[model samples]
Each structure stands twice: as C-alpha cells, then as structure tokens.
Target: MDVIKDFPIYVAKKIKHETVDDLIRQFKGLQANCYDLMINRVVIPRDKKLKEIEKDGNADWRFHEREVKFIVRTENGSSISVEFGLCKTIKSLKDYLYDVKKVSIDQRQMTFNGQELNDEMILNDCEIINDSVVCMNKKNGMSIDIDINNVIEKFDENTIVSDVIKFRKPSNAENYDLVIDGKIVPRNMTLQEANISQQSKLKFQERNITFRVRLCNGSRIRVDMPPSKSILNLKEHLNTVEKFPVCQQRISFNGKDLTDDLTLHDCGIKDDSDVYLLGRLYGG
Candidate 1:
C-alpha cells in the first residue's frame, strides 16, 4: 500500500501596494511558516531563510513592480508604445520618450487625452492602465513663407515688422512695399492675412521710409515701417517682446494721440517721422 499527500498549489503573485509603508506592513503580515514562495522566476526552497532567498537573487522581490503599457500618438499621426513602472510619474514617462524615442518636448507642453498632465502626477493618478492610449501635441509657433521678388523668406506670421526691424534690417524694410496679386500688403498684416504661402510669389519695392520711436527716458529706436501699418499693431508688438504692457502703452506724434483704426499714413506720418512712446508702470 502507498500513501500520497497532495498540497494545494497557490499561485505566488507579487502583492501591489500604493506606498512603501503599506508594502512593508503587508509583507510583515505574510505568514513565513509552511509556505513556498516564488519570485523573479526562481522557486524558493521551503527550508530557506529570508536572507538566503534574497541572496539567491530575490532582493527586489518585495517591490512587486508591474509594467504599464501606453501608446502615445504624436502630432504627425505616429504612435509608439511605451512601457513604464506602475509607480512612475508622468514626467518620468516623458523623460523615457526623450531618452529612448528621441522625442524633444517640454514637460509643460505635455498633454494626455486633451487634459494637460502634471509633472508630479503618477501613472496611477492619471488613471492610466494597461494598453492605454495617450495623445501628445507639439506646441508650434506661427510661421509664414513669403517670396521677396522670387526669393523665399520665412517669418513668424504673428510678428509685426516694427519689432522685426530691430534685429534684421531687410532691404527697404521701412518702405514696406510688399505686393501680392496687385494688392499692397499692409505692414501690420499677419502672414495669415497676407495670403503668404510657400508657393505664393510676391513683389517688393524699396520705399525710403523710416520711423523713430522715442521713449520717455529720451532714448530712441529707429525703425523701418511702412506707413500702412497701424499704431495699435505696433503697440501690440512692443507689448509682446519688450515687456511693455499693451494697456499701459500710449502712442503720440505731433501732440496728437494715435488711434487703433488709423494707420501711420492716415495720421499723416511720413518717412523719418518721430513717434513718442509713453509706458506706464503697473504696481500692486
């Protein structure tokens, strides 16, 4: 006669916890007597001590790390699958993209499913589960391509010429004689409105016109401006690049304040005209 004993096989799975303290408490409560434990693809001997199990390559057994897979869709309609630890943060995932996928992006500009992701938020906090799809958008600045007498030039569509003249002095930038399809392009016009495109051809003529902006401190900056540009648009450019608040900016010439609806040409401003700028200080 033969006697056989059969023990129930318990699937040894890693216990997941939100925090290290919780994991420690749960791990301490696990019964150490009369049980077989398996970790890291290695089976622990029944008579082995905890230190011996660790020395046998189960040092990270208590971490109980799990993998989370997410598919990130880019702006260009491309997607990549990224795998991360469950305890990792959104920022860590971004870093992984940068490191592994060669994606260069700012953390502040990252978004998932139309909602911006916080850097400190963990994958679990974002409710990201296995096989989740994340969408990432790139923040692109406005760009316009123009043809200057058959030569191509690209500029920011949102930028005003008054601000541009400060850096690069294009030929006849002041005269501002840019024409498209027999229509004169206004200096204040954005590239979007100018019908600027990579394929569009435009003509430009040199006009000997320049304007000077005199600050309250008596310092002056000379600019090449087309008289067709509006004073209001100039103020907006100053507000953006020079830290001059638009609400606090005042433009005056020849003892008359400039209005938004009027262009420099309408105000009787000609070449080499001097405009005064009054910027007010804002405080608490």
Candidate 2:
C-alpha cells in the first residue's frame, strides 16, 4: 500500500490529473485499487489500503456513483460499450472512445438532438444513473459522381469544384472553399450563388434534376449566380435587389424567416436549395 500511495503521488507530481485515472487503471488494472482523494468521488479498491493523510478536509468522494454503461462512438462511425461507476466529462468519454474504438479526437465530434455535441454537459447535470444515450455524431452518407472531361469542356482551365463537388457534402465540413468554373467561392455558400437553377444539373446519388422558370418581369430566369456568395449573403444581396436590408426586410423560405444571422448552410439549404424569397414589392 505504501508503494501504491507513493505511485499516485509520484505519477501525479509529473502527470496531469485527467490521465491519472487511466494511467492508474492501465498500469495497475486488476492489480490494485483507485480512490477518490481530491474533489473526485470514486473510491477505488486499492485506495482503501493506502494511507489517508489529509492535506485538506475537502479531500473526499462527493458523489455515491452508480455504475453506468458508457457507449463511446468514433468519428469514423465505430462504437464500443463499457461500464464505469465514476463520474467523468465528455472529454474523458472521448478519450475512452479513442481507446476502445480507435477514434482520433480530430476525426470525431459528439452530439445530441441533431445538434453538434456541446462539451459543457455533465453526467450529474444531465442526470445519467444507468445506460443512457450520451451523444452522437451525424455522418454524411451521400456521394456524387464527377466528370473531369466535362469540367475541362465547360471551362478553358480546370476548376476544383467541377472536379471535387461530387465528393463534398454540406454537413461534412464547416464550409467548402471552392473554385467553380474559374469562380472563387468561400466556404459556406448557397446554391443561388453558383447560379444553380432548378433546371441546372443537380446530381444526387445517380439522379440529376433540372429547373427553368419565369420571373416577376415575365422574363426567363435561370439560376446562374456568382459561385462565390453564400445564401445568407445572397439574401442580403436579394434584400438590396428589392432595397431592404436583411434585418429590416421581412421574408421567409416558404413562410419561415431565416434568422438574420444564419448562413444559408445553417437553414438546411443543401440539395434542393429551395429558398423562396419574400418581402415588400416597393422600398429599398
């Protein structure tokens, strides 16, 4: 027990406390016990035999932890299940995910309720005593087909989007920095900026859809926007088109106002890109 006490103090002297649980568990798994010595409350087995010298009266196990199943999922869509009686943060769960599912922290993101997982949640706050749904990361399961020859034929020079747009997804990246047909579009652009019309070549899986329409002026309208603008930015442009700023302009996509602050990507304007503009007919 003297050796164990010396080990935690020795290892803790140089290492971080977060990894101490794992270091103690890994090197001493099935060989010794762990304890709730600090603000943490898990009373490990071998800890009882070790000396309890109180540097401060606050050193004690606070929560009577109940063993709960932890399901760790990787960014690559792999998952592993285990049980722990100790309370931990999502970061620790992610470390456990990496250990069990071989997931890299960079490649993974955790989530709940279709939103990206927030690191601020806690077990006691979330109230998980047993097997519970912790979090999930959504995976982009769709892909497209690309034609390099068509790209070269469309433009005198090669464009990155013409070559790679098929392989990209809306949710797969924070934004897509694209140069399409010689136009530079920053990440987080909308379909309108690309001048993508309903009749334009829209390829989903193996299906392609095209749209052609008439504008309020009775003139032909084909979606052919500059490829470098985002839908929200485009909305701002549209506001100017009718002489109103986004905040002052009252409009909606099918009767829903896209938040004044939302980028078009934030409003689910991915495949169909069905953004119908609304507003007063007169007044800039």
**lDDT (Cα atoms) of all candidates against the true structure:** 0.58, 0.41
lDDT of 2: 0.41
Q: Give the TM-score comparing model 2 with the true structure, all chains together.
A: 0.25
The list of candidate 1 runs beyond 4 A from truth reads 1-60, 139-284
- 202 in model 2: Cα distance from truth in Å? 22
Q: What is the total number of backbone clashes in candidate 1? A: 0
Residue pairs whose backbone atoms clash in candidate 2: 33-46, 34-44, 195-223, 195-224, 195-225, 198-210, 198-211, 199-210, 199-211, 243-284
Give per-residue CA lDDT, model 2, range 63-85, as digits (tens): 13345675544323344575764
